[model samples]
Target: MPQSSAQVTAAEISRIAGVTRATVSNWRRRHEDFPAPAGGTDSSPLYDLETVRTWLASRGHASAATPSEELRTMLRLRAQSGGSGTSEGLLLVVLAAASHSAEELTAATRLPDTEVVDRAQRDAESAADAVPATGPVRFDTADAAVLRALYACVRDEGGQAALGVLAERELEDSAASGAYRTPAPLADLLAGLIPGSPSRVLDPACGSGTLLAAAARRGARELCGQDALPVQALRSAVSLTLTEPEASVTVRAADSLRADAFPGLVADAVLCNPPYGVRDWGHDELAYDPRWAYGVPARAESELAWVQHALAHLAPGGYAALLLPPATAGRASGRRVRAELVRSGALRAVIALPAGASVPLHVGLQVWVLQRPEPGGPERKSVLFVDTAADGPAGPPAGFGGTTPPARTRGTARSASVDWPGVTARALGAWRAFMENPDAFEGEPGVAHAVGVVDLLDDVVDLTPARLVRASRAEVDPAELSARVDATRGDLVKAAKSLARAAGHEDWSAAGASAREWRTATASDLSRGGALTLLRTVPDSVRTRAHAAGGEEGRPETRAVITGSDIATGSGPTGEPTGLYDGTAPVIAVGDVLVRAIANEGGPMARVAGEEDAGALPGPHVHLFRPDPARLDAWFLAGFLGAEENIAGASTGSTVLTVSPGRLRVPLLPLEEQRRYGEAFRHVHALRAEARRATALAEETARLLAGGLTGGQLLPSREAAEVRGQGGDSPH
Candidate 1:
């Protein structure tokens, strides 16, 4: 390819050269021989990749990259020439070719470029039945590098990995980047929620057929799905067939709500994770949609429309599980539908998941487990409500002991670590129990409760799991509450005292005039100097091993994954290691500095691994910096690397700032000075930790006190000690 034919930005050059983006700009400015802009706007000029690579090689700049990265680069370069339609068409080629054995793929890549293209075109045609064609599939000799890279990616990284890149191109290009696959754990949970093992399953708004595949695992011999995106529909059809070759799979490309693909089909069950909060799901046109058996969903209530659609496709008494945003459970506009579902006994259970469970990771989403009402069957008496979001099992009555991410950190808070297995178990246990005997089911207090439908049918018809489950929290053991309150108060008092001491221990003085300036080195520079090591978990790699014996509990072979949430919240590692990694997860030792991968919020960015954090594996969205204690101080490194200015300078991307490890710079200082600063930062970390713990405890105590008061479990403080200070503040 001509040097000008393939181009990249300064960021891409930085990545290829393993240097900071600033370094690339510096090279462009200072080196007259540096490649000039080959294309793109003046503000964001693109350099020829071949020219840049040659320049970097001549200068002895490091450029040791893996084949996966090479493939990604080739794909990016190709995307510039090939439009999205071509990309979609090419994806079919990938899925088709992915079925070939690694040896077969490797052997094909060694052939002449012309032969490779011909072979790839044959592969695309061969899987026509598995991956239905959305458009014509074609490849030129020019695409040979991409063709070889594609097969290599499938051969090395796995087919799903290659497919993800292609799917991402379309999603990002179309500005639908929020599209994400349902987590496999959540998929299994949804599949397990249905009362019986469904033999014929349907997912109306299937994305990638995750739910349908889950159903397949549960012995569903006939699987059906519909999606609005052709790419997704094609991908799902192939994925479902691959997952269950014996199962009959039918996936059509069409908006299920706007265009009913299976209007007359009935299924044993429906499992869906539909789009949320969409206003134009053909609502005005679908106002009289027969699927609106419950009620005509308001434009804002697209979730209810999906719920009814699932209901419409079900056999009588067949169950449906839909993952919905929390708003859907309590939105006033959907009250009529909620009431109707409750009255007809169609709505069975509403389970709240911990935040970070899936996309829209910032919000704690809910799962609505519903069953179509069978005519002349048993009358529905109550609705089951389970709250996994709160600490009471947890929620406001109790909650996951996770610190709120700093106001600036927007998505995927530490609370995401609330145990997935625990959440699944609790939800499934309550659901199975409820289904077995709805009338006699007495739910676990503070976690789950079965509320009479009459109570739910009240004016609001609000079915938020936390609200319903919270009322039962007051029924939590009074003795347990009293003991917890007293113990937590003591701990809080100790933490308060510690916070005060740490705050008072600071001994540094600010520079008098201009802020102090010092020569600094990027973290990558330090790594080159052997002062630190960077480590990260390949989430995809780690999931393969998730099938091992233990979970996040740290068994003999199991390692707990320390996620960004755990670092931000000062909580124990909550990420369940998906048996995902190949070998061992990056092990954290004391003195290892951890940084959040994204600069989304204002919360603390880094913390030194304490004794409690040792031995745990680093999770996604967490960057690990294990400093050689002899050469660097962990706290000192963490303090400077996590500074707001440093993170801001290092981060890239609009809307979501992703920190670049190679860009994070720290000041060069003597070991003695570093120790002094490290000590102070240590105290600061202690102070912050204590403050977060104290705040959470105080909140919990206040909740307990309020519940106690309202439930008549506690008396007024008539005998309480009075304050001695004269100020009104003391009295208050």
Candidate 2:
């Protein structure tokens, strides 16, 4: 029964339900069953404590309350169903306003200013007594109108579109304030792994509530989110209310690791993507905590601590999904915890997600799906392992959806898109099938495998998916290998022939003795030649800006924004351009020599701009030299810039060396010779283009071969011959 001694006010109800004062009054008048007055007149009519308790417990309301009353009750029920306590009530008001805006509410509700303030204060005071209370007050004291405006905007806009706006305002502010939000797609996938329908879900380290929001969307009614950062708490509260108006979201702004907010509470499912490799996570205090049933996590295994926390909150048969770095799988410091989890049969499946999916992008991340080991649960014989690093749809150029290409020796970060929908469907499908029939689920070749527990108890419980997926045997046909070798040899021979032909064509070495090496004329000297005018004026960066401004290749309207780094990296415009707003810097008309003011101490640098790139201003990162239009053709300067000798003369410095304009040296070759060199430079340019095209073709060929070979659709000719040689023997 509601406590009669507690004399709760209408304002108290508003604070508890997170709506305005008028909403509470309307509920009392329109709904016959709303708590009856236990004391005083209409202005100060008291609510029967028991009646209030019953109202709170009934979860009942007519479908046709006034529009304003319906909205208030919707917010109230959402908070209640989610098991979110009173703190979130203020958030409800903000969400209410955001749903339609305070201005609209003020205009529509027509409640007096004193009434709104009095009711809000009373509600705030009453809510303080409610359990699990701690959010929305920050907004209660601030602009309630702004909160309403945000809700109205989001309601008019779609959820995803709202996120874009929120990202710039709330997300950007939070990011700058030092809290990082996990990408949305990854959070959705991770949360999707939790088993069954959950009445309540918790994210111990819920940063911005991505996982919790996903859980609520998936039909979870009760949501509890906690984060150490205040901004995270605020952002999450706003986000959760916006998404699941019926979900009760209780968010606390405190360190989950240190404070232990919901000490004795349990949830049906726990979804978390905690901070990775945190060095200081309250190890000493939690060392003997009863939650460490699997094993006490070590100092280095912060993820293990989060795992234990998740497990602690899970009811019997509840599931927990954790997104963890791959390092946690085989790290020795947490061997016992890993072993305990496996032996106890709590670990269900481990799947590796593609790289470049998150920060520390080079490292492949794994999602762990764990079921709390129940006393009477059935025994598990195997764990499902999926290697999706290379299994999904095609990705970016030069790589197969992970950090480094499988063919590369060194690890480096690379950009690629994962077939997110495809990957998630495949994984979730496999998991669903496995749950239906564990032993019946056979391993897919190079895709997923259900390895027996005994097999996994090797020297190291190394759960890297790559180590488990067996590589298909090479089906090299002898004739095919021979043909490939022949083709490579032919290319090599052609290169050799070209070397020989060029070697005989010119002998600068033989002529060196006859013509004493003249005093080396610096690039600066040749640049100042009567025929060649220096074009090193525009900074290198501007060229890139202009090039980028030039829309895509076919889009003439696209302007190019050039920069010095563009020339250095050989990258074209990224397709976006920034205008030169600041006054005229250095204009590059055409035929300019763009020099690297900062060059590698012992490396070659500098390139001459072509006529096509003229008229663009160089960014501040480069020095441009405009060639004289009458004396020297731009191609001649470009040829000189291409030469190694000219580059070496201009370079300066030992460590962080920079090339100075005065250090540039150029050969005083006759105009005819310069023109001849220019012709050769054009040929070299064409050859380089051909080489790049060949490289691209070769890469595509390798990818096709890899795909066909792995899919068992292709076999080498030698393998066919071997089968033929064996005469009807199965080529197993």
Model 2 quality (TM-score) = 0.49
Q: What is candidate 2's lDDT per residue for 77-98, written digit by digit as tens?
A: 3332342223344443444344
lDDT minimum window of 10 residues, candidate 2: 402-411
What TM-scores do the predictions have?
0.73, 0.49
Over the full model, what C-alpha lDDT does candidate 2 score relative to the true structure? 0.57
Which is the leading candidate under lDDT? 1
RMSD in angstroms, all models?
Answer: 6.6, 24.6
Give the local distance difference test score of model 1.
Answer: 0.74
lDDT of 1 by residue, 1-732 (tens): 322268988877775665556777888899888999999999999998877888888965544333455566777787676623266556666666656665687887787877877888888777776654466778776777677877877666556656655665555421144246787778988998986678989988787888887787677899988888887888788667654656898889888998888989989999998887788889888777778888899889999999999999998999999999999988889999999999999998999988877777778899999888988999989999998775532322223222321111123463234445456657777777778788988776667899998888888999998888878865667787688778867876887787777777756788898898887877877888899997755533123323332454323336778877567666667655542343545788888899998676455889888888898888767889989888898889999999887887666544456676766888899999999999888878888877766666666667557767776666666434334343344636
Q: Which candidate number maximizes TM-score?
A: 1
Error of 2 at 287 (Å): 1.2
